[model samples]
Target: MNAQTVLASSGDEFKAPGPELFEFPPLFAGGPEWLTKPVVFAVFGSLVVVVFFWSAFANPKLVPRGVQNLGEVGYMFVRDQIGRPFLGKNTDQWMPLLMSVFFLIWIWNIFAVVPIIQFPIASHIAFPAVLAASVYFIKIYLGIKHQGPVKYFTNMIPSGLPLPVYFLLVPIEYLSTFILAPFTHAVRLFANMFAGHTILAFFSLVGFWFLFEKPTVAGFSVGIIGVLVTIVMTAFELLIQFLQAFLFTMLAAMYIQSGLHAEH
Candidate 1:
């Protein structure tokens, strides 16, 4: 049966998840209108990252213990997988920024599956856009500071291109480096989280509707499949969340590194 027919017959109509899923009303009456679920979750996500790292690193140890060991593992993962590869010898200098971006984005995304906090903050495009913008500005500032503004844009043009080719190549490089880069960076993270959460919600709703809300002979099998799919998607979403965080941080590091050294 079609989704509409199934939903109609199910007694409780199923609401297909979409952007409406991300829009939440205020937490309570008299609260600030902007204090919606995603905003609260975003703030809490930042606090969670800060607190976890602080608690992990607060006490000095000859050998790591408790949270510190776990913290070290995460630190090393981000360093090896993201910072060291891109930043090279300067990796240590940029560890804090890279680590912060990694954990913050990760925790923000992990919130998607957390009980009672099932919203991915990055699914709100503005959040990722702001972060990408921050990196973009930093890239510009660092490039200008190290290479000078004139040299920065000038160096952005590939060196080996013939003089006449500047007509074609300069505009392409300018657009790619200065404009499309940040836009795609933000949208990549936002779109992945947005699509992942929506898929999870849709499957979960299917299971809930077919199994609990309206149980029937034919619908029962569909409900089982829904439950199975939801479980699989949740596991996959967790992997995507981690990968996206790593990728975002890696890109940030690459941008910073590019700013520091002009590409030949």
Candidate 2:
């Protein structure tokens, strides 16, 4: 018989709700619960960063051994490959900033697939938005500090434009680079992760739905397909996680570069 017919025939005997997928009920409805999965994940991520850096920097070796080697590689990758290309001579001064951004983003992205903590913090708009705004403020501050207030504004507006075109171009440039850029940066990361997680959740739940909700020969057949799809999606999410982190960091560096060379 078809899965539906079997399910109908089984009725309440096989109608138990499936296990919870990805929800955490608030303790006491309104209580300020200190111990939650998200809190744990955040703390864990922080610890991972701290330990890794500590191990990498605690005992520096000339030849670079153990965690030191890993740390140096990561630092150099961001500093040399990313920061230096953009900031040039000023790259060293910005190493800390770039390193922090790179590691924090990488950890957050990786944690999305960390079994128990399947949710990505960056998927929440607030987190990425705050980070993007921080970079935005830094860019503006650096621009003013290096170029002065009068020149900073002037530098932002493109040169060699017709007098009449200045009116139209100025507003467009201001809004695009200064106002909209940061929002887009944050949204780009947030939306990608959010959509990725949502798709994962959907497929996962669908797999469970077929496996248990409609437990029959036909149901099992379709359910197995869902399982395969879920596996593929999980792998895709892993790639996306790394890509999003790298893109966010690279764009941040590019923004800093723009601010540094706005007068050029």
TM for every model, in the order presented, reads 0.94, 0.85
What digit string (tens of lDDT, one per residue) describes model 1 on residues 45-126? 8998899889899884879998888899999999998888899999999999999999999999999999999889999998
Model 2 spans > 4 angstroms off: 1-40
Candidate 2 lDDT tens digits, 1-264 = 554554565463433322243344554567566555655666677689888989999889889988999999899899877888778898888888888887887798787778767788787676788899999998888888888888988887768878999889889988988779998999999889888877877777657877876566656765677689889999999899888887888888888877776744
* Candidate No. with top TM-score: 1
lDDT, candidate 1, at 158: 69
Top candidate, metric lDDT: 1
Clashing pairs in 2: none
